[model samples]
Target: MSTQSVPVLAANDAASYLDLGITLALNNWPALTLAVQSNWGGPTSDDKRAWLCGAISEMLTERPETDAEDLEDVLIQVMNDEFDVVIDDESAAIVAVEIMEMKQHTDRGNFTEIQAMWEAYQLKSQQKSASAAMFKKVDAKDEDQETDDESDEEGEDVEMGDAPALVRAPREKAEPEIDDDGFTMVKKKR
Candidate 1:
């Protein structure tokens, strides 16, 4: 059974349908069997019908608590591997119909569980990104404020410590000279 022949359904549609079918099969066996037999051609040899059966049953019984896409991915893998037999389009259509019928029995509770899990995951992801972005903004603001404060302090220090210009005038005014008092001392020269 080569995998090249099986038709691929759209991601969302396929996931939803598989989830629904599995949900339904778990609740009712006889009905599920009838549904599968009616649509799928009883069972094919050299192909894995068990996965299809199991998927049907589990969907009805367990009703996935997580990603529906994950469950559908499992189904696609099984179909490609275990049931890769080349069949006519009509048979494929029949298989699809059976799957669709099984989907009808999907438990609402399963949907709710899966949906909640997905939503939580998405919310957590959003929160993480938002926090990171906010931190970046805050850090930038802090850096800017620090730069401003540093510049202001440097300016004040420069103004107060400008002694070169003020000290020269004071030193000239306090002219030191040799007076007649027999001592070299600084005097207020007129």
Candidate 2:
């Protein structure tokens, strides 16, 4: 009899893999990415995204029977509650389906999709860093030009016209009066 080996993943290991897949799936989702990038969830948007990943992982782990529709509903609800965004582009459904597929693959100890997503993520990050560096160089040049222009303007004399002399209204000082108890009291002008 021919023997065949079947891959067996531990419970914790499977959960960890599923969590990673969920993170990568959320990262690639345009709606969620836009929300996080635009700070729609406020200054803690990044934290919110992390929290969402954990929440989704927990939901999937706790409810193994969760389907794409349920996942989609959760995604839409979260975007509305956390980011104040209503998704109407059906992107949430697509992401949900992808995540479900990821779950299936990870359950079988097949991480091809996860590995591919990680590589793509790395490439995207590198591109973003390069673009940011280019922008910084451009901004530095602009700042240097502004400083040079300011220094040149400093040597130029600005003409001022003579103005009329100002007259001040004289104020009458209130004299303090002594009360029956010998306490000094001053009355303010109405």
Candidate 3:
């Protein structure tokens, strides 16, 4: 797993980030906003701040499980540079700041591209399995018909053309030959 840090938005600076996060969420730009909120707490300003660093971290993370340290690192960087707002404001402000950073990192490509790739893989896998199963059933049915035909033949040498279903010829066994020099030649049996 890649090491990711949870951003520590100077506890005083978290409020602003939280607001940005909330705005995006309220404005219907919820993909990134909601995702960030998953890491954020649900109720109250204080609880929301605790989840503040996580919301930004999730935006930067490539997968669902991100490194805490990585999240913290990004949070610190965003707060130190792009956002200078104090973190200790009411929880709403902190939520706003998180929303801002989330907006910055959210990419249309990440959502659409990954979704298409996953769907294509699923479709191909399903088609392959369905094809294999169809072939198997056809093979089994053919085998059953051959067995029935063989039983009806009564040990007779059934003509190949007369057989309704195709039956592969059994391999002929080779016999060993005795050489004039008194050496025995081993023949491969099929």
Q: Which prediction has the highest lDDT against the true structure? A: 2
Candidate 3 residues 74-137, lDDT tens each? Answer: 4444433333333332333443444444434343212332233335545766897899999999
TM-scores of the models, in the order given: 0.28, 0.71, 0.28
Better of 1 and 2 by TM-score: 2
Which digits, one per residue and each the tens of the lDDT, describe model 2 over residues 1-190?
Answer: 0001112335457666677778888888899889998999999987898888888988998999999999999999999999999999999999999999999998898877776776787788889899999999999999999999999999798787778789889887767899999999877669
Q: What does each candidate score in C-alpha RMSD?
A: 24.9, 10.3, 19.0
Sorting all predicted structures by lDDT, with the top scorer first, yields 2, 1, 3
lDDT of 1: 0.47
What is the C-alpha local distance difference test score of candidate 2?
0.84
Preferred candidate (TM-score higher): 2 or 3: 2
Off by over 4 Å in 2: 1-12, 157-190
